[model samples]
Target: MKSGTVSQDYDKNETDGKVGLKRRLGFFDSLSFLVGTIIGAGIFVSPKGVLEYSQLNIGVALCIWAACGVICILCTLCYAELGSSLPFAGGEYYHVRRGLGPIPAFITIWTLTLFIRPSSNAARALTFAEYVSRPFYSGCPPPELLKKSLAIGILLTLGVINSKSIKLATWVQNIFTILKMMALTLIIVYGFIEFATNPDASKPFQDAFNSQFPNAAQTAEAFFQGLYAYGGWNFLNYMAEEIKNPSKNIPRSVITAMCAVIVFYLLVNISYLTVLTPRELISSAAVSVTWADRMIPSWAWIIPVSVAISIFGSLNGGMFMLGRLNYAGSKEGHLPSLISMLHVRHLTPAPAMIISTLIACIFVIPSDLVSLTNYFSFSSWLLVGLTCVSLIVLRFREPNLERPYKVFLPLAFVVVGVSAFLVLAPIIQSPKVQYFYALLFMFSSIIIYIPFVHFKLKIPYFNKITCYLQLLLEVSPTDMFEDSKTE
Candidate 1:
């Protein structure tokens, strides 16, 4: 592995006498982060899309949800092996670098950090703002400015907390995860109540299997909804270096979290259907809100408050991972070297976190987030599919790479096949101009990477600039390799 943009990731950086990021996350904290990241606004809103796409066939929709969870676990196991063996901050980027090559790796982190991640963070923040501000504007929608401001404020607030202490960030994640889980428990419990007291209301299940199955296209769309909701299944891998006992906990936590999310998702959707029939579920703009309205109109406020809190925890978890991605990229010299530095005393990537939050804030101001999120969505999945492919490549290429948890090669292959379908299905079914643009945008990173990063484009007096940022941010820099430049 000769030095290239991120090829150095395959080997360790010789110690530079500087303190690195402390491993602060235990299994509990790691599980909390994964669960919180996965159960975002998706479960609350996406059930409707799944049901609608599956043509109100409750049985098929449930299967799609379960299928998506299984697919995610398979894909995540492949990452578990990488997280344990490679154990770096960048997650997929590091795995791709070692197994595939530096260019693909650089392209992944670059496109994600620059576009996909920030846009995602922005979407989460905006949703959080809307939920929180809705009460105040019950007469009409809240002013766009109010929502954007609240969105930016929350993003920055989380950034500051992450900057100060990893402990604090994980603590916030844990509390939020618990709170959201409790909310989901309430939903599941009520669904049980609905079944016990009023069997007629649970019509979706009464003759669930009798409804005609959705066509192939509709089934794929339903699965896509599930996949979208399950987006952050791999988030824990990115912070492998920060987790305690990476080998055991990486696989254990990811598996545990996904299982819990699947149960919660399945039960919650079942709960929703118990109260609202297929027509009500599909017709409603928001599934949870409608469920709450019918189930307990007087206590309907609870769901909105819970959703706001859920999004809060999710945003915190996402920002933590987003910051880590930036730090990881910088560590590999794919991003500005300044971002790689850890806080002097706290050993946190405050600069990277803040920069990421700022970019997300910029994205929050946009009025049309759906268009923004859609444009970059396919590329995100494409990279994910490629990362899974890297797992297969590494198994043969580096059989001796000391895997703490080796995934079954066949399961890895299955995930790769599924990933290929997911990455291609939308384009092949109903091609969109944005999909083409996204492909161009994703690969364009290669053109920029070749000269600027791969060649280590030297910046005159960059050392002075790095020193200034280090002093201002109180961060310690990693030792750079001979071929590496400031950025």
Candidate 2:
């Protein structure tokens, strides 16, 4: 069955007061949503990984980064078509569910709510906190309380804004995104000028190209690691319902955002390399500031502020869309009903926002932004592979569904999808994350197919254990497993 033809009813008793979601986001807002989520700590921290991998040849490293951007763009194309066709909020959860069966859909949703989305937002928040505080205090910094409080504070502020009005939220998103892009542009332009005049600028392109990694495998490995830095290009697709004219805007936003980020990334790295030696760039934790100090000569004061603003904007965008995933699953009766309940006044899913935000805050309290980003990269890429496969499955199972942004060059998507899987496999080095993904899927399947579905399907002990553990940890319930009716 095609996704469009899937039944909306799932043993529910809904006959009155049913309403559709509010649509308030426009093309700019949607575009910001994509870019803001993508340009976070990855740009700040991933340069080290790239420099290490490319052995200081900033030009070649950028080419590899751009290559990854191309793959992500292809994935965004697939998502854009699917998102517009469905035009729902749950992002991948809704599409996967409609294409696959309820059980499998539940699993994808599980990974999203419990691990993927929440962890990412938390990572962003912590990065925001770090950048916000780093201006005055040097050294190792203060205790966890300061960072956690700041992280939670940002979450609460964004959550409240989102809960109040979709229009307000999108406007805020637009302003922040514009600020971030402008800041990046200024940095890139100024740094390029500095590179031209400075005697000790980056080595000639020939010298950079001649440099090699210790081994070919290591170079390939570093290239793949760099790919993880560009993971959030598809985040905006999750907000399909809120977007204006999703059919027209989804593809536009996805493609434009990808191009913008790629350009921003290439220029920023070029700027950084021009200012700092490859060794210095790799050694210092604050590469952006280093570039800013060297290039801006006059506006050094503005650089730290710019970094903070960029990180804040990125955090806001991630949280705004992440909540929608939970909301979408709830609407489908695959997640908790609370998640689906929009604040009547705010027109946003407040409960889901609160729950997701809390989880992010909790996770960010201890870990460094780089390590947390790596964790997000490994886990998110694994699920992304599954989402890609789900796309192929849906195409075969429901070929007749209307797609506004059809991909004519499907081979491109397939190749990129397979390549993405290859890039992600090495990072799944840990047993814990691997099992986490597996258990998350299995638990979601049970919730989607059994009791909530009114089927005689039986669940295994492992799922039961994981489910309770999740509940014990206060993770939002997976698989809107019950009807949205007053019992």
Candidate 3:
């Protein structure tokens, strides 16, 4: 296996004299990316599944959320150290590439670009459309065509926003992040008021721990649901190359975002339990909407609107980071060289954004939210485990390398152990054919890598083909060509 250090890679980049991504994101922008990406429609929609899977036990469900929060924080610390040390655009893929090898990195990004990210974006887009159409639905659910159209429209809209300017995307993220926070704040305040004034509202907490315990499969599924809500905490790391003073801001943003999210998630769940019974929470398709209807009927419409805005912000953040990942992969020649180009005017990865958005739109055709979630969670956590393990490997392989931030070894082990459990628990509890399909999807990267990456295969007239395609797509030639490297 080929082994190399990130410092060596940095030296190569300097020797190659590459034009790099512009550093424009500051501490607050990075924080907004972290927080905004994480607080998506999952919190609004997944709680019902979590409660149901946990057998409607308020205590177990909350504990699962808390535990996932802790695990996420620990995992964030690991990412903090890696992001500060490497400060690259590819996030986990870059970390794993430098720490493990090219093949492993290729596999990570392959699965991510092909499956994980598109599925996630599609899921969020569908959720956004569902909530937006909820108030319009008189009897049955909204028409499938309408939902798909809305999903595609939002994806394209966010794709355009991100492709145009990072500054604009950050502004959208910041504004919507605050709006979503306020929405949560409203829920928390109302729930606390109801808990204080109405003694009957306190019954949910009276026997919170008295419910029947769930089986192992159910517990794993519930934990997976909670972890999905906490998924985006590490998104900022993907664009660490763009963050100002990433060494200082990466860890700071991660710690702050994780802390705030944990507190808000706990309070939000508490608010849900306070206002609605466990049975009510499990039965309701949209728990936040239900809370709003019961607690503030006059302004019940606000919740779905808030959710739509929140999911939109998340879609923006996801697309922004997804483009960066594609750029990173392309820069290293793991993907098509065209995708690595940064637009001359906007200084954004336009090709990457366009391709990712197109794939996400394709994913919208399949409306299996549950299967998408399971596939995303399993494959994502599996890669996360490998990435965390890469941290330990790098520490030993390059003991004297500069680390602006470092996670303690014990905590790193905890992240690895927890990640392993998260990856394997569902499979152990209840094996599914989809799990195998996910694995097959990951392994399929190797087949492609061998011909394209390992053997350096190129089709006849590949450049000519890309040139014509680029012109047809209106991609500026200056922005579509660069000296590509595979490290």
For 182-295, candidate 3 gives per-residue lDDT tens digits of 988988999899989998988878888899999888988888788878889878889987877777899999999999999999999999989888888888888998888898
Where is model 3 poorest over a 10-residue stretch in terms of lDDT?
A: 477-486
RMSD of each: 3.6, 6.3, 3.6
**Cα-based TM-score, every candidate:** 0.94, 0.83, 0.92
Weakest ten-residue segment in model 2 by summed lDDT: 6-15
lDDT of 2 by residue, 1-487 (tens): 2334321332121233344455567787788878877776667655877777777666677677788788777778777777776676777777666666566667777767766677777767766787777655777785567777888799878877776667777777778778778888887887778777876664654366766644565566666666666767768767877676777888899999899888888888887777777888888777777776666657876766777787787778878777888787767766655566665444567766777777776776667532544444444655565566667776787687666777755753674466575645554533356445445554656655567554534456745764564454343332332222211
> Between the candidate structures 1 and 2, which one is better when assessed by TM-score?
1
Query: Model 3 shows how many backbone clashes?
Result: 0
Native-to-model Cα distance after best TM-score fit, residue 5 in candidate 2, in Å: 9.7
TM-score computed on alpha carbons, candidate 3: 0.92
Q: Which digits, one per residue and each the tens of the lDDT, describe model 1 over residues 114-145?
A: 88888888898889999999999887988889
Which candidate should be chosen as best, given TM-score against the real structure? 1
**In candidate 3, residue 118 scores what lDDT?**
84
lDDT per model, in order? 0.83, 0.68, 0.83
